[model samples]
Target: MSHVTDVPAASPEIARDHFLRRLSVETDCSDVAASLRGGEPDFVLLHVVGSPQAYERRHVPGARHLPHRDISAERMGEWPAGTLFVVYCAGPHCNGADRAAFKLAGLGLPVKIMIGGITGWQDEDLPFASGKEPGVLRP
Candidate 1:
């Protein structure tokens, strides 16, 4: 049999559960772009890696710079506990997004990873923002 069929696929119910669970914690570049382009995004988008200058040079428009190393409960308290955070990093090669998500979750905050990160954003030709602020997109 072809490698594709080497292992049977999960049943539809099982597949739905698996995807639903994944969707709960992850988002894609396209979805994020659409949300940003549409207007005010409901979730906060954060860049979880790089220096301030690097972020200013180029980053998903409206994304706030917040390295994974800097995430802390006290630092995150500026927003209400329920504020959902969507984090991204340099690309699939980077784990900074994962680290940030862990910290945010540890603080009992809602969080999700913007899958594909900057690389994905670039792939989709989405606009980026700069400067320091609410980790949100500029109008």
Candidate 2:
């Protein structure tokens, strides 16, 4: 058999479960951008990497500057217990998003990773917000 078919695909039930599970914990740049444009999003978007200066240089429109290292129970207390956090880092090569997601999950909070991160966002030719604080894109 060809290398492409060396192994059969998972059963439909298995594939369904896998895709559903991934959707639950992950989102892509396009989906996020669309959400941001659709009015107030239900999730809290966070730029989970870089310093304040780096974040100020460029970041997702509504993303807050919250480094993964700063993620903690006390800091997260500002949000409701059921708040859903969407995190992203430099790109797929960076683990800041994963680190933030892990910390959020450990804190018993809901979280999802924005899969393409900044790189992916740029790949889609989307505009970024620049400023010293969060939600700089807001009117």
Candidate 3:
């Protein structure tokens, strides 16, 4: 076996730990869909942007809108303590979800990023809602 000095491979246990930790901070489209179906109260889903146009076009059903630039610890403090927030944005190419997650986490709120985002949801053929109506999406 040849080993590269610049890129050392992680041991199996280390890799598993890293992946598990990542899973704790990230969720996928299917999981989010299931949560919506079950109406889980442990977490709240949010779309981290203020663009009414984008929102009006399409977004996850039941996701609340919160622009990342406008997020604040004081504002977040109004939420019930220990409430986990699952945030997403346009898609994998967008860093909005990561940015929002970092901001919320810094504010001491539990946060998870919905991997793949709205684009991923659509790609998976998941239902999406448009307009200002929450939880009502066009199939």
Candidate 4:
């Protein structure tokens, strides 16, 4: 495992080192979508809805709901065995995703946090579903 040093230095080595470290265990929203399309993922996608009403309005496709306040041992099994997990919340500045990521990682599961969260996904022009996700590619 590469060491992740949270330094502010702008040296080329530092930036390269950071990128290499992140490459070992880092993924983003686009990766998740591509995996879903290819049907070859080893992980499940989870979206922690900060607000029930917002969740009802729209969310990522195929996301399983695990409210922030409701994540616990009892619900940890909601995820699949040996599956990597990706967690996202309302958006940036939202602790829901961070908390969920920490909790899943603590449970000894490989997990990735969508740093920008759902808001960032939307900002990037990604598709979302309201009501039912249909579990299919959206136009």
Candidate 5:
């Protein structure tokens, strides 16, 4: 038998459990939107990267701008303990979100990746704000 066949396939139950675990750890655009609408206080949305021009073009309504390179525990000190930070980048094509998430998690902050990033948000026809004004993006 080929070397690949030597490994046993995961049982259906095991696969299902793995999938559920992964799903539980990741947040989707719709969930983020709902949380924003409900004014959920347990989590914060973070925009991982995007230039000023990019931000002006479009961005998640309430996402805070913090480049991945600048992410640090000190910079995020204002947040309370156990805050679930939902981080996103430009899109699947961009890995900034992954980098930011890794950094934040390493810093002992609770973090989850916003699957699909801003592209996914826009794909869902979610509202986005333009310009440099903070908290100006409205649905």
Candidate 6:
């Protein structure tokens, strides 16, 4: 009998976790702003489920929209290959951001979830587009 060494591939969950930990190109709103001011951000903004309404009302000016549910190879063509992308949901309690990150990483794209989502951005007192609220942006 011959013995063969076998190693399992990393699961999606593990892959997502690993990617998040190793991310050095990620940015929150403040970082995003700095990058934008410096010319362009290092990453692209991705909106999770139900975030469209909020996004359309106001986003980071130049941010492009990539809805979570519509994520796929076909839809991904709109974005550059291996672009440093950041996914964001409504808030910390939401898992949409993480889910989006997982999907993006699975496609071999360098990605990360903006830890606090839009809520955190507001907390930073950063500039954002407005819609329903005086200083809030929503689609």
Which candidate number would show the highest TM-score if scored against the true structure? 2
lDDT sort, best first: 2, 1, 3, 5, 4, 6
Off by over 4 Å in 6: 1-26, 130-139
Model 5, 59-138: lDDT tens per residue? 88788888889987788888888888889998999999999989998998888899999889989988887777545333
Ranking by TM-score: 2, 1, 3, 5, 4, 6
Estimate the Cα RMSD of every predicted model relative to the unseen true structure: 1.9, 1.5, 2.9, 5.7, 3.5, 9.7
Model 1 clash pairs are 61-128, 61-129, 62-136, 62-137, 64-135
Poorly placed runs, candidate 5 (over 4 Å): 1-9, 136-139
Off by over 4 Å in 4: 1-14, 23-25, 132-134
TM match of model 5 to true structure? 0.84
> For model 3, where is the 10-residue window of minimal lDDT?
130-139
Better of 1 and 5 by lDDT: 1
The count of residue-pair clashes in candidate 6 stands at 7
- lDDT of the candidates, in the order given: 0.88, 0.93, 0.85, 0.72, 0.83, 0.69
Q: How much is 125 displaced in model 1, in angstroms?
A: 1.1
Give the C-alpha lDDT of model 5: 0.83
TM-score of 2: 0.96
Instruction: Give the residue spans of candidate 3 off by over 4 A.
Output: 1-9, 136-139
For residue 83, model 6's alpha carbon misses the true position, in angstroms, by 1.3
Per-residue accuracy of model 2 over 28-57 as CA lDDT, tens digit each: 998988888888899999999999999999
Candidate 3's residue-wise lDDT over 6-118, tens digit each? Answer: 67889999999999999999999888887787754468888997597888787899888887887898878768999999999989899999999999999889999999998
Error of 5 at 116 (Å): 0.6
TM-score: which is higher, 4 or 5? 5
Models 1 onward score TM values of 0.92, 0.96, 0.86, 0.76, 0.84, 0.69
Q: Candidate 4, TM-score vs. the true structure?
A: 0.76
> lDDT for model 3, on a 0 to 1 scale?
0.85
